[model samples]
Each structure stands twice: as structure tokens, then as C-alpha cells.
Target chain A: MKILAAVSRSTVARVLNCIQVLVPKPHVAVVSLDEEAALASKAMGVEFIGGPLPEKIYAIDEFKEYDVGIAALDNDSINISVVKALRSIGIPLVISLLNNSANRDLLVKEGADYVIDIDSYVSQNIAASLSMDKWVYVKPLSIVNLTLAVVRLARRSILGVKLGELKSALRSKSIHLMAIDRLGKVISDDSVELNAGDIILLTGIESEVYEASMDVEKLFRRHEETLARSFAESLRASTRPYG
Target chain B: MVFALKSRGKVSLIIYLATEKGVRNVKHIYKSIEDSISVVDTYIVYYGLGAFKQLMDIPAFHSEPPYCRGKAILSGVNLVTSPVIVVINGDTSCFSIDSISNAVAKVLSGETLLHLSKPQTNTDFTNVYRSFLQDILGELGITQSMLYPSYSIIVGLRKFFTTTPYSMWSIEQLAAINLREEALVVENNSCIDSTIDYVKGFEKTFVKDLARKAVEIALQRNTISRNRAEEYLKRIEAA
Candidate 1:
């Protein structure tokens, strides 16, 4: 889809970089709150136009020259206004960026076909990060309350700890181990041991989910401390130069 | 021992193991589920993480080699029966309960599970720093606040600097694991609730501009007739 994103200069640039990865490279038109951003976006292979809400509406005309009118601006009001204006023009599919919680209903009432909230996106990132067994993925569930995440286990300093022990520790926090993703399948077997780099598909409450995430970190820390102690002891016994 | 259970004939039993966080509320959800469906055999697991930890004390539950892919599946054979597995997530918060309930129900119904939760909001440091910037600009009695960045800029920058790398890493990891079988059930009540706050601001400025831009872009692309574009422009101007 041809996406016209109206954002600040810096955000426009960042969006330009991120969009290529999130979606197919479309005819991206960058509209900024500043004029320089417009020029920069055009130079960066995005259709650039400058101006704030309402006034910036004039720039949308430029995109019509390219046979696409679908646009999503960063500002909720601007996107809604743009969508409303397009609706009157009988345009189809006007999506707005709804940044605040207060405006969601109003935007829907005002005729926003789709509203993308950045805050919600961020929360999803945080959830994703919590789900990570390896390095954290900051935005795990952007779709809100309807996501299943599969995360790989990180290489922990703690080795040989049974899955049963870990589960017990996590159980104290009310976290449940839904299924373990090992090799390439989901294992619900209770007898399975958790190995380093094993992927776990965890399902639970948000806080519990986060708590379960912390348990993995705690296990790693405990393992690392144990390993360090043993390594020191071995070094002392061997009289080897401790690196 | 509080146990929240729900089941449909011929389907898996969906249960939410209650914890102190929302053990009280779990009764309500449990009742609601029971009212909706016929629950089969049920078991009461002790509430709290301590109980779970103790349960794990059993050697059979301990981590071991060869890995147990659920007793029901075996090498070119199947053994254990598919008794409704009451999967419990240790989320005690109300939000967690709701999310877990939704996920479990979906799984039991043979639906794909998707993780659902509220979207994270940006902490408005702009408003905080806005006052500081406004104070600096106040010396000249020029309260225009142009020196201050917009909330979008602040949010965009924060996301770019802090969240981008993490998101990229996650996407990469998800790709590597490639486990696409199980369905993820998610709840978006918080998302829907939060959007109400920004509606007015959106209606006043952002929506207005967005409407105008839609027309402009349509006109620019020649996707719509000039007359239609002009009409759109007029409608927004009128609004």
C-alpha cells in the first residue's frame, strides 16, 4: 500500500528506515511538522511534503499525481482529519494514528477507518521483550491481549538445573509453563529438561508473564554465580595463572 | 483451594489456576465459564507460587535428558491419554487473568492462540520538560513553545533509541525458532479503553489535518477526480 506518513523530521527518517522491514516497500510519502523533513524525505526516496495539520493537507495532492492516496500520519488528529476529508471525497481506507487513549472512540466516531496507537505498539514491544528467553524483545505483544509468543532460551550461567526446579521457582510467582519449544516442536511433556537455547512458549497474566521472564534471569544469575565460585576454587587448587 | 474451570463436551478443559493476585475474582470468571459450558472432572491445585514450586519438587517433573514431549506422544506411537491439561499461567493480576482466560479458552476450542495485551504508552516527558522549556522561553514572554519538541518527536526518538534494536532482535529470533503451530489468544480491552483518552485531541488537530492530507494525497496521485478532491477539501474545511 502507498503509505503517506506525516511525522516529525526525525521520526519520518526513522519510520522510513523501519517501514522497509515492517512492510513491503511501498511508495512512502513523508510529511513532517517541519519543511526540512519534507526535503529530506524526498531525497531519501520518500515523497516529501511539509506543514502541520490542516495546512499540510495540501501536500496530499502531490501523492495523487502518483496514483495512491492511502495515508497514515503520526499525529492522531491529522490522520483523523485527513481520513474524514478523504471520506467526504469518497476515498476508501483512511487509517489514522491514534496516540492517546482518550481519542480512540472519538476517532472512530469521526470516521477513522483504522487507528494505530504508538503507545500500544510500545507496550507490545515490552511484552515481547519479557517473552524473550534469550535477549529481550521490547515489544512482544502489540495486538493487545491476543498474542502467542515463542521465545528461545538464553545461554544461562546456571547449568544442570532441572526444569522441575525452575518450574517450582516460577510457580511461586504464579507463572505456568505452557509448553517448551525444543529443537523445532512444542513439548508439553513434564519430564523434559530445559536446556540452554531451548525455546519456551509461555502463556499467562501480563505480570505473571513478566515474572516468569524474570525467573529465567534469576536462574541465569544463580548459575553464573555458582560457575564463578567453582572456577575460582579450581584455579586455586591447580595453582594455574588465573586469566 | 480455588480452581477456575471451564469445559465444552469433546473439547479440552480450560482452567485458570487461581493465585492470591486475583483469587477472589477468579471465582467470578470460573462461574462465568461454568455457566457457559459443562465442566468435566476438575482438580484443585493449591494457590500461590510456593505450592507450584513444591509440586515441582517431584523428580518426575524435574528437567531430564531425552526430553518429554508430553506423555501422550511417543516414538511412532502414542501412550498417555489426552486428559484435559489444565495449563496455568502464574499471572495473578486482573489483566493477566483476563488474558490467560481468553488464551486458554481459545486453545481448548481448538483455535489458534495469540498473545493479547494492552499497548504500552509513552511516558509524557515532553509535558514535563515542556514546562522547563516554557520557563526558559518565558524570560522573553514568548510562550509560543517552538523550542520545545512535540510529543511525537519525543516518542519517536525514545522508540528509535530504546525500542528499535530490541524489536529487530525479537523479529530475528522469532524467525529463527519458526514454531508456528499453536494459536495465540490475546485480549485488547486495555487498548480499547486507553484510546478514549486521546480522542478529543485527535478530533481537534490531528484528525483535521489528516482529513485534509487525504484529499491532498488523493488529488496529487490523480487517483480521484479533481472535483472529488476539491469536494473533500471543502468538507474538511467545513468541519
Candidate 2:
């Protein structure tokens, strides 16, 4: 994917580096006023497009190649303006990083797709970690208004139950069981019995996922701390080619 | 440990140093791996002479200007007396004993022609530095062993480096490319991280030029077929 990271701070260099990592085969072009940010992005194989930040995203010829535009300017006003400019240019998706929380509503109104309030995101995240559902990993799938959850079954009643048995519950809740992360080898096979250290990945509408997550905690040794450690071990082992 | 025991003074270690951070990393790496009885000697390959004023006692080579990764490594490889040599990226953040010892063992055991690592702690985060033409380079039958020079900590036979030499911006890639199927991949945390300040300005055209030159070098080495290289050249140009 062609990504235009219109950055204003050197700190965004690490963010750009991360984008390049998470997004597979990303063609990231960073437009930054800061020389440090520009040079750092270039070093990470991201193209440092040198030019004044134009009113419209397409004004820079290289940006026309990019479908997604991210406005990460330091000021909320600039971010709003860049987001508006990007939206005007018909960029498929325009995401703005709101530095201040006060202008969030206005920024959201102006920025069509997303106005990410980093402060709120972090605080809410910290809040979530302290909640009763802390054992379950939940990430909001924004575009669809759905939630993807990884739930560890806390009880032993789920043992000997085939994965197929959960399909009925999943169907009733309208939440799909995406994959079973057992010691990290993500199993899509329903034939596999619900085993210890299995963390089930569920996705559906928010209400349904929450309901499923609560229900999942009642059965099997998909216990919280157990799967978190073992599943992580599996994932680490899988990514390491030598091991 | 057995590898170190069997290969005493039979293996030489060369650390490729480029940035200022690499100078410190080299000293850290030297001190960490100093007691390995398997290593015959340690060589520091820096960018220039001035970079090594404080780095006394260890024999070092200095490469001047327009830093080419291939030239720096091959130059050091040429001077090693050991049958096997391990070329490490000096910018790597602390080499662990486990990683170094395992690689040495693997090479000395004659299990593989070249042993390379996928840096879990690498600065780039991912193997994002995989050859620019990686998507299609496989079709051309050219495989890259060392995707990023920073992750180019490799243990291999000395003859492999002395022969089949191609020095461009991607000498390490070409070396791994030449290894073909004989390269072993080990997961290690020894790679330049984001903390290192190795910032160098480069334009798209310059990068494209480097890729073209890389393709040309591969074509010359018969590692890639002429037709495949031509197709890639066209594709790269269009891109």
C-alpha cells in the first residue's frame, strides 16, 4: 500500500518505522518539515519527499501514487488543514493525529475517516488493562464497528469438548471463531479438541464479542495467565525461523 | 563449545564498522566475544583511519568514502589466515555468546556453506531490507541470504568470500545470493536498531540506480539469467 506520512516531529520516525513493519509491502513516503524526521524516514527505506506541505495532497506529484494519507503534524490546526486537504484530493483514507483533546470533536467533524486522539487512546488502553476483561485481548475493528477479541477459557469444563461444539455457540452469538491460538500454531481446524493453553480469537459486532468473551471465560483451561504465556511462546517460536 | 574447541585459531572474526555508534558497538562486541578460544583473531573494518585511533591492539582496515558494504567486508576477508571467517555488522547491538557460539559451531561442523541471521532485535524491526527486487528476484533464480547488511552477521568458509566477489552497495546480498541453497538462517538479536544514528540522505533515483547496479552485478555473476534480469530491469524502471 502507498502511504503518505505527513509528519512534523522527529518522534514520528519511530512511528513510520513501525508502519513499515506492520503494514506488509508498504510504500511509505514521508513529508516532514523536520530534517531529522526526513533523514530518519529515508534511512528506514521510506522516501523522504522534499517540498513544502501543499494545500492539497495531490499537489505533490508523488502523493498521487499514495492512496492513504496520514496527517501527523504537531499542531491540531495543521493536522485538521492537512486532513481537509487530503480529503479534498480524494485520497481513499485520511487519518489525522489530534495533539489536543479539546479540538477532537472539530477535528473529527473535519477529518472524514479518523482523528486519533493519542492521549485518549492511551488512557482508555490503560483503563482497559485494569478492567475485569483484562485477560481478553480486544482490538476494535474501526471501519466495521466490530471487535476482534482473544479470549482465554478460564474453566476446565471446556476440556474434551471438540472445537465444533463451540461453533453452535458462535453461530448463536453471531460471533465467528476465527482461529484457536494453541501454544501459537493458530489452528483453523474445528476437529481439534478444546485444549489447555488455547486462546480463541473471536470476531463479530462489539456486543456479540463481549458476550462471547464473558462466556468463554467460564469454560476450559483457556485460563487467562496460562494461554497468555504459552500462546506467546508459540508465536515467538513460529516467527523464529531457526528455532 | 565443541565448535570452539575443534576450531581453535581456525576461524577469524571481522567486524564491519561504519557509523560512529558502530565504533562503540565494536568495542562492546570485542569485549563480549574476547574470550572465544575458537576465534584466531579479530579485525575491525572501519570507514576511515581516524575512526580507529583509540581502537589499538586489534588489527583493523579502513575504507575511505562513499561507503560500499561489499568492498569493506571482502577486503577484510582477503586478509584472514583462517579457513573460515565470520563477518559481523559492527552496528549490531551486543552480540550474545549463544548466537556467536552456535554460528561458529554450525559453520565449523560443515553443516552449511553460510550461516545468516534474521535479527529479532534488528533496527529495521522486520526484514524490510529484503532485496528491492525480492518480489521477482526469486523467479530469476537469485536468492538473497543477507537481506540487510546490518543483519549480515555471517559465518562461512573463507574461500566463499575470496572467490565469487561482487562489490556494490549490496555486496552482502550478492554474497548471500551466491551462496544459493547452502545458507542457514538463525534467529538472533544482533542487528542495528533504531537507536543508532546512521542517517544518510538518499534519493529515489539513487536507490533505483543502486538496484539496477545490483541486478547488473547478479547478471554478470550468472546467478540470474539474462532474460529474468531484463524483465526485472524493465519492471524496476517502470516502478
Candidate 3:
């Protein structure tokens, strides 16, 4: 497919890199004011349009034949203007790189088919990685306004408790223990005992699931705290004060 | 940067963590953000009984038994004394200091509210939520194509959040208020509400960077305190 890529400054490299991976032997047309970008585009064997974007794009007659257009400029206002112009000119698919989060919805409203904020996307992925243990899988049950999350019950306090006993608490948090995995075995039965290392699948809304997970952690901590306190008390009672 | 902000003396950030799962996620999130940017006060506003006695010294609020989204937010808001408050979901990944700094900049620059968007997933639930939100906004005379706020990261003036009514519909209400104020919308969406998402996120370059950065920043801030950030970094390294 013929592609029109509009870039400004350092973003040219990132945009070009992405395009290279997306299409083998890509016939992309690059537009930018950066001389280095023009040189880079020439090196990549893509058509180069060296000038200011959005306005420069409208001047190119060959742009009409392009199936997709990408506005990956660093400036939000320029990106928005260029994407708006691209959309107005009937580019079937237009994507814009959003540098600022605040401009995301504004660009979307401007008719860009897909708006990506690279920073947010990357950071979100990073954030998700940091907290992987809380929820294994989260599928939104659209019809029920609930999300299904596969959670590992890592807290020892909640171990050995029957699912039936935790039912009321889970229910109060809007969570349902749909299934449990105990040492490679999946148990759908409610009466099975919960173990410290068992994987428990839960379903609830985002808020509900969050609360449920917190409750589970609390149980584990409470168990540990009590054990620690009792052990400390026994040691104190068995020994005399040296002071 | 949380500590940096505190040291600067010109500004301060109060981070409100909304949780129902107790301290497991909160502890990790707190240290990650602290490591990534040691410039803020992190508060744990929870619905659970108590597992966070260590944070007892830190100002906190307890939501009434049986969690409610609205109450948690409102309770956190009531406790916030900073000019700006960042209300983050406990389950979502903690944002880097730069992200929070950017949000504060927008807040200071006349924007009334800033809502961070999550990456859009083509899930049945997202479609449903989008359609519902679009229809509701349409009826309210708001443009359907306008930005919709994700509940993951919300930053605004202290009074704005504290004064708003707390309920399950608070997010919607916050969006509506944003519409009236012409709020800033940033896209920084990451919610691991499921195993699938968590796995996908773990496999990404940024997620790995997050763990690494957490360690680097933690070590830079305080080598003596082997906090959760260190623990998480070790786990990531081992994995």
C-alpha cells in the first residue's frame, strides 16, 4: 500500500523504524523540514518532501494515490492540523502520534482513525509489567459490567480457608471465585480448600477486583502478623529482663 | 522525584492510592513511584481491615467495610491537603515521576483537570463501555468524539476532587466536569485487570524498563532502605 508519512525533528527516526517493520519494501513518502530526515529518507529509498508539514502535504498531487497517511510530528498543533488536512482530503486511514496526553481526544475528534501516544503506551506497558502478580487475565464481561481476573492467592493467611467461607466477603466485594488451580489441578468446586500458592480466578469490575485482591493480601498479612506476635510473646515470657 | 519535590519547597504532590486489596499492590506501587520519582507524598486509602501498619505513621483513610469506589476516592480527597492531588488506581502500574510532573504542569497551566487515557483495546467490554459513554455524552450535549477519561490516572485541583460527590458514577461525573472545564486529556493507559493483560505487559520492553528504573532510582535515593522497589527489581532480574 502507498503510504504518506509526515514527520518533524527526531520523531522521523522512530516513525521510519516503525514503517520499516510494518511493510517489507515499503514505498513510503516522507515529509519533514529536517535536512537530516530528508537524508535519512533518501538513504531508506523513500520519497522525500522537504518542507513544513500538513500544508506541504496538500501541495503534493501524488498524495491522493496513497492509501494511508501518518502524521508523526513532535508538535501537537502541527500534528493535529496535518491529520485534519489528511482526513479532509479523504485519506482512508490516518494515524497521528500524540506527544501530549491532553491532545489525544482533540486529535481523535479531528478524525484521525488511530491516535497513539507513544509515551503513554510505553509507560502503561511498563506499569502493567511492574504489577503482574495481582491479576493474571482481565477480560471485561461487557454484558455484566464486570471483569474476569485470574489471581494468584500468594498470601498465606488466606490459605486453608474454604471457598464457601470466603464467599460472603468475595460477594461483598462483587468478586466471584469462578475457578481455582491447585498444584496443576483446576477446581471449579466451591468447597475446595484455598492454599497459599493456589491460583484463584476471579471476576468483578475494576474497582471490585482491586478491592478483592487487597482483601486477599490483608488476610495473608494478618496471619503472618499473628504468628510473629505470638512467637515474640513466648520468647519474652520464657526469658527474664537482663537490664 | 517525590523527595525532590519535597526538597524543592516550591511545590508538593500528594499521591492518593485507592485500594481494596490491602497493601500488596499499594506497597509496590508506592515504592516504584518513589524510586522512579522521589518527589511526593504517597498515601494509602484502603477499604480492607489492615495490613499496612507500617504506613500507620503516614496519613491514611479507611473506607467503610465492603468497598465502594466513590467512598474510596472521596475519603482520599478528604484527607488531601496539597494544592494538587493525584488519585491513582492501586491495580494499575504506578506512573513515573515525569508523568506526574507533566500532569502537575498541565494543572498549573490553567487546565482544571487532566485525565490519562489507557491504550484502547478492542475488547467487547471496552466497546460496550465506549458506546455507553458516547451515548450518555451525546444525550448530555457533549460531543461523542470528545475525549473520555480513564479512571486510572486523574489529576486535578484538591478542591475539585474533594468537593465532587462520591459514588460509582464518580468517574462519569469527573468526565462531565472536565467537559465543562475543557480539561486536558493525556493517554497513559495501563490496567492489568486480567492475566492476559499482565502477561502481555510483562513481555513488553517498557514494563521491563519500569522494573529496572525502579531499582536504579531506589538505589539513587536511599541505598540503606531495601524497600519494595528493591524486592520487585530483584524478582524481575531473577525472572
Total clashing residue pairs per candidate?
A: 84, 5, 26
Which CAPRI category fits model 2?
Answer: incorrect
lDDT of 3 by residue, A1-243 (tens): 888999876887888887888735567999997898998888877788897656677787878888889988765656776886788788999988876544555577667887776645555445444443465444332234455555555554243656665565566675666545656776756787777556666676767876786776566566567777988999989998779
TM-score of each: 0.31, 0.43, 0.35
* DockQ each: 0.01, 0.01, 0.02
Candidate 1, residue B209: the lDDT equals: 44
lDDT score of residue B98 within candidate 2: 70
Q: Which candidate's TM-score is highest?
A: 2
For residues A1-243, what per-residue lDDT tens digits would candidate 2 score against the true structure?
Answer: 888888876457656866867746777878776788867876787788665453335467556666898888765545665776776677888888765454555566655487666644565566544443244544443356566666444354244556775675566688778555546777767787766556667788878888886766554334445666887999988895664
Candidate 3: residue A211 Cα off by (Å): 35
TM-score of chain B of each: 0.28, 0.78, 0.59
**Which 10 consecutive residues of model 1 chain B have the lowest summed lDDT?**
B151-160
Stretches > 4 Å off in candidate 3: A1-243, B1-22, B32-41, B48-57, B119-128, B139-149, B172-181, B190-239
lDDT tens string, model 1, B1-239?
01332334322222223234334444454554445434442222222233223222111111101111111011101001123232222222224344445544554455642233333333343343233333322322222423222210000001111111111001111111121323322233332112222222333343334334434543554556788667656755675
Where is model 2 more than 4 Å wrong at Cα? A1-243, B2-9, B48-50, B120-131, B140-149, B186-192, B195-199, B203-210, B217-224, B237-239
Question: Candidate 1 versus the native: TM-score?
Answer: 0.31
Weakest lDDT window of 10 consecutive positions for candidate 3 chain B: B194-203
Q: For each candidate, what is the lDDT?
A: 0.42, 0.62, 0.57
Say which candidate scores most in lDDT.
2
